[model samples]
Target chain A: MNKEVLKALERDARTTPEQIATQTGISMEEVEKTIEKAERDRVIVKYKTIVNWERLGEEQVQALIEVKIQPQRNVGFDAIAERIYRFPEVRSVYLVSGTYDLAVFVVGKTMQEAAAFVWQKLATLESVQGTVTHFLLKRYKEDGEILEGGGEKGRRQPLTL
Target chain B: MSPRPGLNSKRARSLISKRVEGISPSGIRKFFDILSTMEGAISLGVGEPDFVTPWHVSEAGIYSIEKGYTMYTSNKGLLELRQELTRYLYTRYGVEYDPETELLVTVGVSEGLDLAMRSIINPKDEVLSPDPTYVSYGPCTVLAEGVFIPIPTTVENDFKVKAADIEKRITPRTKAILLGYPNNPTGAVMERNELAEVAEVARRHDLLVVSDEIYDRLVYGVKHTCFASLPEMKERTVLLGGFSKAYAMTGWRVGYAAARHEIIEAMTKVHQYTMLCAPIVAQMAATEALRAGDAVVKEMVADYDRRRRVMLKGLNDIGLACFEPKGAFYCFPSVKVTGLSSEEFAEQLLVEEKVAVVPGSAFGECGEGYVRCCYATALSDIEEALRRMGRFVERHS
Candidate 1:
């Protein structure tokens, strides 16, 4: 499964093939081949940096927009799901097993921009019964990273205890 | 100013046990003293996870407190907790242990190590362990009045203590072999077949084996075979494990020791007198850790695996010859390329670049030309440390 090369790239896409070989104890040629194949197959979709936008004063406005849609004549949620996900503002779309039909994460630069996209584009779509938008007020965590708690810092610098 | 109260007090020194006095102080202490005084020094020396106990486990502790379950637990710790450990050990290693008499919840694997040493080691009995093991093993053995014998290992053989070497060192007085795999400074692990060889030696010699598997779950590219799971070895092996490394529960002070009933009984007697019990609240949290913390542990290990890749590649790329460490969060890179002793390299690197790494000599004499750099830090910090180390190495060269 070339787990070593895939894991290395998943951690940091910037890691060179030589580094992956050294890290995984694999030959450089093997690492290069696995990575090339993975890239060609689209198994490695993207390499991204986790940005703390708040520190840069570019706090993004994010909202979870839950949608309830009527089943179509034949295609059901997939037809409307494809249409909603096609929008540039939609970050993620999920057919949740819950009170809602589809849950989508929408991001914009400002609250007004997010509301405009919802009111202008989403509400007017065919078979989109209604949408409940919840604006994110804070982020204590993101993408499995804790954004808060600098950690109650009174620990003495340990001498290998 | 007048001299401090115990600055030169001979009597005060004598008041400490002779065994404790006999043990040498840590060689890394002087460097750490300077590192502590220096401001803005980034340390890659601490051998611990950067993550705190997962929120769900912490919440369970708080919930137990809210329910007022604040009372002294049994000396062997909570039955519920021990039973959970039983199930866990069984599932992970296929080893069955009786919950009531064969398991003792301890105050971290540190306590379990001490208890195992004290319970079995009579005065002047010898215990064989690898050199450059966790710092506490030798001291713990000495504290129990047993002689600590270091079986030296080099970067060769992937730093695994050879079974032949261990057999050669055994004498009539040798009572036990102490091992920690997925090891600390070197991050060495033994393959199952290799461990079975050691188990064969122990069986032949009729020696007790205290195996510390605290870093059992931290392995990459290898499976950690529980020593007690070996054929007919359950009765002879004291399996020590804990939540500190795997569950990021260092502050909770919860761990376990499982063996035959005789050993657990002896250990519980010492544990009862000394520790009373592992904190009850922490026990509740540990119960929750066993029940729901598997996914969290997997996530944390995934994070460590990525860090391992970066740290190993970065050190080797910087011209420090480091073998790929398959377990734990440390990268032990040889600093011989700079022609500087590990101690000198650690000190100068800290002073010049404001980055701190542990001199490997602090682990053992055989660890002299290497440094232990932990990767359980922010990736940015690790990268920055590597850059500074590269500059330091360049200047030295």
Candidate 2:
């Protein structure tokens, strides 16, 4: 696979295959073939956008829950992680190191809904021993992107020496 | 009633010094003045990178302020920054310099250029430079009371100034040869063998060589040859480099000059007297750039390469014949198809299409008939600008 084409897509998924070919010095057919193969093999899992819901006044409440869980026979934490991740409210699940065996990112329309998911659903899991929920207060950055104050206005003048 | 008599226009004009008076304003100044008032204009005019200085580098500078390191550095520069810069040069170019003696950091490559001119030039001493060069080279020499001789370079030669062409302009009073490559205006990079020949010419003429390598790190595919790295040339060459183009640190105003101790001492004398030092904050930032900014520069170079391809292909497809610019983020496309002079084409394009580009003649006489389109803007802007230019070209051609 052409790693350059993949990198270009990773940076901006909207970049056309034609642009990728030109940018990476690959032939158009070759770029298309590589991208097709990558998608089929699930190398490119998703083409996603990072939207600022706060700007739209539709900000969703989110919280991180550190869960202490008992290991199942021969499965370690994988079975528990899979069960937690399968929940609709869970945004992400990690088999973490340290005091907690699992870290779950739970999102809901409201803080009460998120807390309900943590208490009624997550804390009552068969293997879950205890949990600590840290509700996200405000996001300055998310997914490697700054959330605010980055305007598209040009900084330098139109002419220079 | 006549006690408050005022000088007339001619008398007032005559009151200015001959040196400053001889230097006319930049040819494109009036054009840019018009551009400043026009809203919704997309510019491919300025040579600066569109990217902000990498956050980590800026944070390092800001961190210094938090730690209360805001005082001016030494007249030469911060010792650590100088050492870091010299080490970078040595490791990358295999050219060694004594940081304490041979390096003097100035405000920017702008100041580095000015310092080199003032240090080496005497009255009537001619400095030969490639035509269609950076805007400051000739004016700086002239300000130093030196004659600025232009060696006319053309598209036929791919804008690389030849040693023989440079030799033709030499005379008894010629004291230096000035070169800026991976050049601005033309985006021409002189190959190593070609520069070895120029080094030979300098040796034969026993002339000082001032090489402006501000865009050195921005070259594509091909490697950049440091002028001082040439055999027996370092002693006589004034090497000027900066973090502006490569590191996107133009507003920081920090650059450096490297040479033999004697020449550097002379430059430092002038620098200390006129401007005491480069801002300490800038030096700290430059030090961070040298230490950890390579990956950032590499990523930027790749991005510029992509934009360069899009621009070169788009311009050629639209009938504006353009040479492949292998360095810097610019495409110097000949606007000859439009049947208008470069200035006329630029003015009409801005007014008619709201697309701004610098007219080639603003660089030098040989730069006529072409316009420099910087590809450092966003990909979307470049594509849009090309569309507007295509329409403009179709109508004019």
Candidate 3:
């Protein structure tokens, strides 16, 4: 694993290859080859942006759904987890160990749409026994970024010893 | 003797004491004053990190306040904080200090440096330090009633002071040798073998060595050698370290000094009477920092290393000859190619291109031909500043 290159890209996916080469003291060609190999090997799955939708006056609703399911023959939670993750509305799915068997994150344009997904799709799965849903109210942080009050930053004096 | 004409203003100023009056104001102050009023100026003048204190460290301080733990700690500081510091020192450098007797916490390395000088210097004593040194060292020595001696270092030597240069400047009244590496202004890191030679000079002369390691953790691709950790040197060295640079906790005002028991006792006596103790909330935060600050510091260091490389290359690419700084966040590039003094270069750049840099003369006499550019800023701002500086350099040269 070219951890240094990966770390730079993970911090800011838009960082250019030349910048990575300068930062990690690797040659430009090596950096390009390593990134290409990593992408081919699936070490880097995808590059995406974490947008603050509220700033644009867009309404978005997100919810977490805890699902309970009966284990099927030959394929336990993997089969059910895969089915839950394949939905476009489901942002993420994880096999959790607590009282819940699977934890699923679902996003929609409105609260009604998100709640409808829990009732219409998740609760009606064949092996699903029960489910609980919690709607997210506000996002104080996402993807390691604080979502508020950074406008007041850069108050440090222009010059200091 | 009779209250002479109620004192003219000039006489009144003189009454403030010849020592304080003789000390000139910092060279950095004048440029920064001009910078403050300019609109939309991009500054590479500040010497501090751009990151805020990590959220967890700040949360710990808030938690302490909620618990009503807002009382003054012991004169030496909270025992638990001291213990944590000793463990860190030992683990990192193999140097052990007694938490009870050998460590004293202060407001910052600023205060620790002051206390160290006050506790050891006597009238007419001489304190030898490298030229192009931190601005505070010379003033602090003078304030402690000691004579400040400068050993001039050059870019040819990568700004590392030679032991022979130091030995030649020593006099019978010389009391201590002061060192700050990963130096300010120059960003030079002293190699271990070179420092051992300097330590030998101190040992032979039976002089104290006061080492400031505030930027120890900021070195790029090089290991920092703790002067006190050198063989047989711990007993004669007073080590000053702080959280300001490493953990981005400048406002917390927490730092420490470690030495033999007697030295700590002496510094503690001065600290108790003048400042009382570092704030209790800051102490609590510092303790939390020692416990959980490693990963945060590692991330910040790596980020700084990247910026350092970019700034180094940018300065050289623009026709300014810059020595590669292996430590700290500054790039001291010689601006002599422009046929302008360091101050003139800084002033003209701010006026013409709106990019502010500190004149290297602010550090000391030997720093006249260079200007210090700090890279601890946003990457975009650094790039923009470099573009502006390139334009300015092109016109003048």
Report the first chain's TM-score for all candidates. 0.88, 0.93, 0.93
Each model's C-alpha lDDT? 0.90, 0.92, 0.92
Clashes of each: 0, 1, 0
lDDT of 1 by residue, B1-397 (tens): 9976755688778789876778998777787788778887888988788887888998999999999999999999999999999999999999999999999999999999999999999999999999888899999999999999999998988789889999999999999999999888998888999999999999999999999999999999789899999999999999999999999888889999999999999999999999999999999999999988478898888778867887888888889999978888899999999999998999899999998889998888888999999988887788899999999989988
- Please give the lDDT score at residue A146 for candidate 3: 84
TM-score of chain A of 3: 0.93
lDDT of 1 at B355: 89
- Pairs that clash in candidate 3: none
- Candidate by candidate, in order, the iRMS in Å equals 3.7, 1.7, 1.3
For every candidate, give the share of true A-B contacts it also has: 0.24, 0.67, 0.64
* lDDT score for candidate 3 against the true structure: 0.92
For model 3 chain B, the run of ten residues with the poorest summed lDDT: B1-10
Off by over 4 Å in 3: A150-154, B1-11
What is the C-alpha lDDT profile of model 1 across A63-149, one tens digit per residue?
999999998988979999999999999999999988989999999999999999899999899899999999998888777666768
User: Model 3, residue B81: what's the lDDT?
Assistant: 95
Using TM-score as the measure, the top candidate is: 2
